[model samples]
Target: MSDDANGRRPSIRDVARLANVSYQTVSRVLNDHPSVRPETRDRVNQVMAELNYRPNQAARALVTSRSQTIGILAASSSMYGPASSIAAIEAAARLRGYWVSTANIDASDPGSIPEGLAHLRAQSIEGLVVIAPQVRVVRALAAQALDIPYVTLQSTDLDVDHMLSVDQVAGARMATKHLISLGHRGIYHLAGPQDWIEAEARMRGFLEELGASDVPTTAPILGDWTADFGYYAGRELLRVRDFTAVFSSNDQMALGFIHAARDEGLDVPRDLSVIGFDDIPEAAHFWPPLTTVRQDFAELGRRCVELLLGPADGLESPSPSTIAPELIVRGSTAPAA
Candidate 1:
């Protein structure tokens, strides 16, 4: 039986005719209806496979009113943290047999938030994951009054019940404490953009640690979370060279800062100790490998899916809501000279 005997793609009716079963029977099999006999279901499935029949997901969704899809509302998605979280959520959603729909919006524009939500809601997503890392974005999302189960990846304290995040403040504190333990009092912080919630939390952690240790605080230099900014900041900051160590918000900036340091004839961890966040793939390969903080992005993704859809079968219950960040000590940091 050819799929295009009449010059049209094969339909469920084609499978039914070839398997000698009713179209209703094929529909039951497609839905895993238990009333269909095992032998009959097997035959229909075999015919479907033979004819390369694929059910129209949109049509099925219309009939059942369940799209089996999740939506991601993202802003600043090009950055490493948001980008990684989105990828993780997609991978986890796929494992659970759900399709993912993403709607990217401008974090700076409040109007784009509702527009993005409306676009995803039209697809009938069963759940939503909000990857808005900015404070204003989260606040804008809250005003929309979304009805579906939703999880926000950033910890803004705006929606504690719906937030899942790595403890950014604690992670920053860990990085700061590591430098302090090494006897470095003259430390400077390279923070992400001021609007980012993670950046704010990290800066808070750094400040809190400095206060606890009685180390005089220096205002953090805000950057756009790029190596280019890090390079320029490094060049300007190094002109005075008052600080003995620097803690960057992310690894890319750390890499750039290191480059600038080298350009100025400063050896990393010898002239200045450096540490970064995210421990990006290239962190380990930097000239003197980057000592940085690591967030379990994969685990974070799995948890986001589980939170919105519940735990997967045969798997343990979801771990704690806040994933702890790990400090990976490497060659970039050392005791201040």
Candidate 2:
């Protein structure tokens, strides 16, 4: 309740003096040590609050050798999938009473991977979550030989013990099968950039399903996972009027493709059926309400936290590393006319 005459920030000693406890007791309370009595802990917390004492996380980490922080080394963080995963991880980490520090890296620059890792490590992060969606980024990460527990959000068959992700291949297959069931033999796939892991997996699944069902397959068009690309590609592809349906890599592109369809005086599902992946928040609001594949990004984030920091308070067992994606059918497609 008293202000320091020097007008300096309150320190742990000040908190201990005000709380009538030893300096060690304040440290234990800061660390959440179980040995501290409940009443004493409450009293010290009250004093800390009254003094507005903020613990220096860096100092605490050096002394305790446990930062109680998780680091996210992310590449291509601006993209929807990676960005969503980052948000999910941060939320999950907060639920577990830990802080999150993120270091965004240019995935194209191999040199930046180590620099990003070093920056996070300097904070003494106890665990790491990697949002590397490119094969090259994953490869660059694997070379680091990190000493702490880490989890990668993409499935690359490398360090399976540390990998967690939604099953992209299966999700794509679900999309393709949905179209095939609708009696659309001529289907085109608008895939993500060739190097992206999710894009490749989805394209693979699309081709696999078409081959299995005897539906003739055409070479997929590689896209940059943008609405602009989708609109342009759709304008070009629709000129030929070859395929009855198109499965876009993500909802953004699907939105663009639908726009192009409208421009060309075509009615969706009546003349052309379109589907997309990721089931972004806007997907359901798209004109005609796009039908798309949904990945449980929340679950993926929770699992990443669990994999790195152990299951949350009451979780007795860890969830599987690979989450299955769900097929969300909306108004985007109907029986092929």
Candidate 3:
């Protein structure tokens, strides 16, 4: 027992005694030493929890010579994918007993990139997870070496250090193919803004799928991934009366387009078909129920933590991974009417 000002505080020895193990066993459990048995580990953990014991982070840091902190440079966190990824990263980091420092930047603004890095640097972050989706961020990182270990979370033609693209191209292809297979030939596209790696990859997949079938595509409407822009895009698209189906880059845009179509007295699936990517949680619960592509943002975030820290249990390197997307069909899409 360690003596506090007023009373004897519970120490590792006390926990060990309660758990019927040596203090060395408690220490091993705290340090996550691999030699301990699973049942013993559970017993020690239960004892610690029962005692409400908290480890001394300062002593652990001194022993490890690490701050035990990771930094996240994320963009478009208001959107579903980025926001979900950020949450997953935070959760994963917490499980590993590491602190997270996050810096948000508007991906469109180039000036904020280095500034965000500087903020994390000041915090002495041991590793970095960069989730900026723009190509320029990749270029900027390449131009100057921060000399800190970092992993990027987007597709880049140039080989970036420890970067993973989640296969937006494949996801987009799946989205387009779904529309095409439903007999929608005159399909228009709603895409994210330019200079974004994900937007570009998705656009490429859409066009490639269409080209393979000799189906010509209309000029795409570029919009930020927002319901407001989706509404604006929907209003603009109503003037061109040729298309019977639309492929939106994300679900919020699809919802906006639906609202726009309904306002124009056009019923979904009866007048037009719509498909969107990133099957957000609300997609299934939407009025018509959206047909969308599902990206595993949670998996992406877990992979980021694994890559930033290290792969567990003889796992291979985490670079060059692209999670495949799945197509979810719903009432929002149908055969061209």
Candidate 4:
């Protein structure tokens, strides 16, 4: 028995000898394996509690075929949705006793992302989770063949297994319907870039909601997912000055619109009611706060992992899973005046 500089406790081997069990048996009991006999498991557990023993994660991984690692292919962007989704995935993976290897990609370029994904595949990863929402990413994925089971946190026209995403249509509808309910007869929409799936989904939802409303709908004002685009678009929108409310595709554009409104001397929620999607961290802190849809991104991560690792849910015409968006009522919204 090796003694510490200040010897006070016995080691795992000592516990194994005292319990009359193999070191492997002791390890299994510590891991909470169901196969261990009840009395032996309890006795080993009691001894471990007394000795304060812990298993090394690296050692455990060597024995199990699972490396306890998950690979994440994420887009590096200032957009709130992608950033929040990565954070959630990391947190959930850590909680499940798995380590994560992330490959940050540029969503605008498909080649760069595929190169990074190729590197991840070389690591012999058990599973892959991709946070791909852009069209370029989709195009790249469509061109490739995957050897391992994986999941995508995206909304695509093509059908695939293990997909988790917020119902963009639902969120758009919620935003527009909220504005319409506030007596805003003329509602303008500031949509995201046309190429993105999220932008298309939001636009579809907005059109559907407006079509359902008794009031007439106006054509959308196009903008990129940036405050600068919104600023420019907002400035142009001021020329018309007919709408009472505006629904922005995302928070960044909404912020830009708010700035533009201020420059034009229009008070938010008073002169012009505005609604935005993705209730980002700073949304509540923005001037007069922002009334937006809260998309649960972390939950998306957990569900994606579960589906990918879960029993064969079967790919024979699998139904799409839709997570509803939450409508957050904040200071930036009010009845149309």
Candidate 5:
């Protein structure tokens, strides 16, 4: 009797025989051999799936000298954006049948970045997906050259790949321009803390919009990405009565800003027009629902895996058409008083 009668785990040979293909053809399909006939490969894969076949990872790794494990090296994933992105990356990698290893570091610590990379290297990860929202993390990674293929989610403008989805600069610019179009000349930007790439990009976009419109911007208040910090920033801005509108780097901050403003007897879109990024779920429920930019974190994660596995070198020169943030108009923003 065949081993199948004993309810043994299915193997590649069994799948090959079931599909009526040679063992070599099965192997080619497993390795994604480009020369293999598409129909034959599909047939082999179908049978393998039907048989609930599982590849021997140890054997495959030994044969190819590859771990078949992808590493997610992330910085400060406590924030919604990074957290959501990591989850999506995991989902995408699973669909491709690759193991995922995660290493999260605090971007505030200069040494944390290297430590995360080292942890992944120890796992013999085939490639890396770096989700560094901070500029310093990228700089540190640059100092330590990566031997294996790595994909990053930050826009470095350096001729490297993995600058996938999310044109944060454009998104920020869109938010700022929307405020400007509403005649908000005295726009105050409550930006993210320094060293973060997204924070810097968003700041640049805010400044660029203010400069082009011949409007002098109020000194930006840089704060940690937190509701409490946003509240603090909002109260502090009240001291400088020059700005009529404020653009926060994230929705959490915007929500806090609104709360603070309410305490100061400021009605949103009336006494102060506010906008934010990321469009977090609660943004819509905030007092006078917030106007914010929606970033596709899931798509970004999917693309990061694709780029890491595929040739991401061609993505060095950014194509802005990749991921466009949609501006969600709500009650938070209005014409300056």
Candidate 6:
């Protein structure tokens, strides 16, 4: 039994001795080398079972030239996009037999993204995935030297080797077009920060829908994609007194809009119609229940991994892709008042 300085006991040597085999034989069995006979493997397995031998992670990494780890640099917390995307990537990576280590970055700061990337590279990470949904992050990636195999989530920039995003434009179109179909002519939008790629795409989709239809377009109200911003924007909606239906950039903003509508003594779906994007879990439980566009962030993560591992021959073909958001019709949206 080899006890480390910390007094942990029972190393591979102890297992080999107990199994009546040389340490080299035990190494072969542990490393899945084919030289070991099945009977010897069975005996080693019995010894390992009895002694509870575990290999050191660092030693294994050195031998195989692989860390068996993936690095993820992501925003600490902004909304469902960053948080949900990280969770999805972690889960999918684990399923592929890789461990995930994450570094949190400030969503608004370009420097934070690269700083996190530096930390990950220092760890000798084999691959890097960035969950940067904002424009700052996009620009940071373009300017930095990301030499490792890299993938970006929630950004549409094809300049990167691999990229994936929820079809934000399509989602916005779904949200706005849905409102238009409900007979509302005066529709308003609470857009997310202009610096975020998703926000820009969503805003574009909303405007394109209005432009394509007979209904007129009002400038989208800017919001920061927070419940408070939504709430405050909701309050502003009361003063405008012109638009009958409002489409918010995300569910958090939608929640604020809902609260603002309630506080202003207006009935949902009766006096005003409201819809949102992201279709968050709580969206269905709002006062009148929300009708919004639902995006599959988990699917997006899986797709990112696939794209990162995809064949590199098709460099010029349609590499850019989009995942469309599904519209969930709920009680919050109704025929215009």
Candidate 1, run of 10 with poorest lDDT: 312-321
TM-score of each: 0.81, 0.82, 0.78, 0.76, 0.76, 0.78
- Across residues 1-337, which tens digit of lDDT does each residue of candidate 1 receive? 4358577778878899999997767866775555679999999999988887876654567898888999999998888898999999999999999989999998878977766776676566899999998989888877777788999898678999888999999999999999999999999999999999999999999999999999999999999899999999999999999999999999999999999999999999898999999989889999899999999999999999998888988567564379999999999999999
In model 3, which regions exceed 4 Å deviation?
Answer: 1-63, 106-109
Best by TM-score: 2
Give Cα-based local distance difference scores for all models.
0.89, 0.89, 0.81, 0.78, 0.80, 0.79
Which candidate achieves the best lDDT against the true structure?
1
TM-score of 6: 0.78
Question: Candidate 6 regions off by >4 Å?
Answer: 1-60, 76-78, 158-161, 309-320
Over 4 Å off, model 5:
1-60, 63-66, 108-110, 311-322
Encode model 2's per-residue lDDT on 26-64: one tens digit a residue: 876775655689999999999988987866665688788
Cα displacement (Å) at residue 89, model 5: 0.9
Sorting all predicted structures by TM-score, with the top scorer first, yields 2, 1, 3, 6, 4, 5
**lDDT value, candidate 2, whole model:** 0.89
lDDT over C-alpha atoms for residue 314 of model 6: 40
Q: Candidate 5 — worst ten consecutive residues by lDDT sum? A: 311-320
Residues 170-235 of candidate 3: C-alpha lDDT, one tens digit per residue: 888888888889898999899998877888888999999999878887777888888989888888
Q: Clashing pairs in model 6?
A: 231-256
Q: Give the candidate order by descending lDDT.
A: 1, 2, 3, 5, 6, 4
Clashing pairs for model 2 are none
Of 4 and 5, the candidate ranking higher by TM-score: 4
Model 6: ten consecutive residues of lowest lDDT: 309-318
Candidate 5 residue-wise lDDT at 15: 83
Model 4, range 135-195, lDDT digits (tens) per residue? 7787787666667777777776654556668899999999999999999988889998777
| Candidate 3 or 2, higher TM-score | 2
